[model samples]
Target: MNFISFLLFSALYTCLASRLGDRTLPELSASGITTLITTPDPIKNVDPSNPASHLSKILIPRVSDTENNTIVRDYIVSTLKALQWHVEIDEFTDKTPIGTKRFRNIIATKDPTASRRVILAAHYDSKYSATYPDDQFVGATDSAAPCAMMLDVAEALNPLLDERKKRLDEGLEDDEDVADTTLQLVFFDGEEAFVVWTATDSIYGARHLADKWASTYLSPHGKRRLMGTQSTELTGIEHLILLDLLGAPQPSLRSYFLDTAWLFDALVSVERRLGESGAFAYGEEQGMAPEKWTTYFQPRTELKINMGYIGDDHVPFLERGVPVLHLIADPFPPVWHTLKDDATALDIPTMRRWNLMLRVLMSEYLHLRPEDAQPHSAVRRDASEL
Candidate 1:
């Protein structure tokens, strides 16, 4: 079978197996199936010395500090640019509890010509902790790890994106349906509050950007244009997958929104297969067992799907009728917002597992063909670069 046909068959088999229980395909090896589906180079080459390596290394204390904030902002922009993505900085000053402070949101896009977009986002700012010393509070798992994972995903998919753009530019395909879906990465600023967590103090960048995008006019291909009578709606956002508190070991992620419950289950399945393949077995660290992981739509007794809401950057987009997949641990990690939330809190095994899971998820989501996975030059960098 051709690569695309093989992928479709695999997806169909997975859905069927998921619905009818693994008993239906009793002889099928879950890990084997996942390996067959994603036939390109796996994530075994993701080394510790790579550019997208440690999350704690990219952590900054707060976005309120101009110098530090610019440092973080430039790092994100340069990283995305290195990955060959179109980068933009949404710079603005907003009124907060501690008066007006400058905030910048880093937006990066692949396949900018595609009208429909799938967003992979994370808040880059560390929370302002009055209890801890200013220099001591580095939000590693709070969001730095998640941000690093997003960048890694973008880098992994760069080959497919470049191929799609090349075909479109050379007029190899005459149909408009051949256009690929865009992947947009957003690094939100000011998700943490200066003093107290209030509506006015938190999620400043998300609120501002959501409103701005909603009011602005864009052509069908996503290029910004003059505003007409009808403004661009939030419907162009196909799915917004927001990751948070992700570096800790063995996190139990549940679906928060009912609409995107399927996506959540797919990720859970990916995690399970990865575990069965011993993908989480990194050195001495024994990650979460397969049984410990949970899915949102499992056949249970009395658990609600959309139980409660955790306020984050996706709220503004969710309020505007955008479907969201929130990948956050229900019970916050042990070192949440504490002095220990530094590099000590991060588990290398857990980060490796997440990295593999996202790579597979994005490849499946975009329906990337095996031939499209072209080998790119290594992103060489020293530890002192960032």
Candidate 2:
């Protein structure tokens, strides 16, 4: 991600943020949050020391257009596919500063038949380096941990999503419109520029995907979001929550858009509940214990437009009028873009907290009942029906 002067584009972003309608997410029950956190073993996938973990698999020099990029893309695809998600690979070639290169963005939806979707996304590709050792930059906090946390959210909530589907099918769901919205995870490729950050050089996959979705018209049957008007894939999105620069300790996050401020506050609520419940107290990280943990989100003061915006994959989507919640570290970790951004830069307790936070946040966002989900089952299918 790159930084731009907030003064240069504050008005433009404020206008875009206002285009989004207000959204209210149901809060998960204490037991539900506990079930979601404990069942999936929140620390498993994000643990860098575990060779079989998702982070370990993704912690490599996966520069876009390279073999490592393909490997990481395939890994993400297979993981989502194992959970029976509808996965689509947006493959294309675009001109870069260096030359034309191939980019594939992974789009995984829990229920492709849903009318609308809320996206959780992060970039899977690492920064490109010209030298050998420099090329080994893994981008652990840059995005690898965020990607892993996305996977963890999927695993933790898959059963609850199934239960929600069952309720909807049985006509027992409270709100059909809310139940119609599904979860979609997007792993954007080429988010990192080949050279310095430039409008054309950065976020190649996002720019392409956003443009494609904007133009790809959906049939009237699925255009229920816009009062029977013709809608495109982009219009079917309720909100796009983009995660970046996570997995590091002591990092601060802020609400970048007025439209998603409620959603950001919703996430802060999840963290607060989990912290007070002692869920973040992992091993020796006593500071994260109940009443001792610090907040990742800064306090929201005046209810005004944001002062600036960060240049990331969400830019194209937000410019196209998508409600965006950009959850990126404000200060950029101390190891930003350096060779030191390997596994050493990631803190397990921090990643675990992120995992739990996503599980509860998404569970509440989707109105899923994690209380109905059981732990350790192959797919939580053996649990009592919702």
Candidate 3:
């Protein structure tokens, strides 16, 4: 109320804002539907290729922590350790002058010595609260599904790779044991928009990784990558498979077209291979296929990949020139950002099926070669994007 008191308060507020870094949040109302609803092909097959029984069997408790980010970072770390992979918790030490939430990423690596690397990523943090129903927002299917599935796959693959290494030492001629790339599993933080949309409120974790990987790591092709352009900054990256909202009824792979075309192509192949089609047939008959599905037209401008981009941890990597494959649902899934976005919304069987699809694609991408190992398709293909 007094002049001196007002001046002092203003000065303190200015300092806090400066320290917080003027990151603008997106307008929540700006989040809109870009895709036309259409009848999607049904899915049929459901199988777990790796049979990581124990990994799938375990119950991972992920709670919403007010102090911590919504994601259970410790749970992710523990899962990685169980697989025997060396884990690193990359800490983000910056704190706003006023108050700030802690941020970090969990990295699980298998063979650091390998020249090539594969990064499988997912954001662990969920929305702050239910934006819809009168319930707590538990992101069981949105992300917890991806995280858990990746954990199972990692656990199964790590030991398999280790065994192959042993046989090679014995001169057992293990060509199949040869891996084309080292795998890195990163659990990201700060994906949700703080104020719900502007720009700076999204993608904190991925941006950091892009800068580090592009500058510090050498590509398998041995190109001087980021060091070539914007080396002092972050400008180089080739690929990324960012899993989000993967546990819906029959989730479709909808995202920025430029970066996700290859992944999209692969998904079609996987759907056929895994027999996800039958499910879609049922969907069609059940009238679950959206009303305005279009199979041939180019995605609309608003749908112009970037135009419809739902800002998340993936954007930062995309900004750094990483070709990020955002494996997310189309139309932003109705339950998104709502209180209904909880375990009750998850379809266990559907989640299991999607998990199989992911393993199939990742294995294809990994292209592992054992001295006498076998290559098997992870999918049964009967489902598709209607």
lDDT rank order: 2, 1, 3
Candidate achieving the largest TM-score: 2
Query: Best to worst by TM-score, what's the order?
Result: 2, 1, 3
**lDDT (Cα) of model 3:** 0.49
The all-Cα superposition gives candidate 2 an RMSD in Å to the true structure of 4.0
- Count of backbone collisions within predicted model 3: 48
TM-score of 2: 0.93
Please, what are the lDDT tens digits per residue for candidate 1 over residues 137-168?
67878787888788777766677667767777
lDDT per residue for candidate 3 within 270-301, as digits (tens), equals 54544423322233243323342212113334
TM-score of 3: 0.64
What TM-score fits each model?
0.79, 0.93, 0.64
- For candidate 3, the per-residue lDDT at 241 reads 73
Best by lDDT: 2
TM-score of 1: 0.79
Model 3 spans with C-alpha error above 4 angstroms: 1-71, 94-98, 129-135, 163-180, 214-238, 276-308, 369-386
Model 1 global lDDT (CA atoms, 0 to 1): 0.66
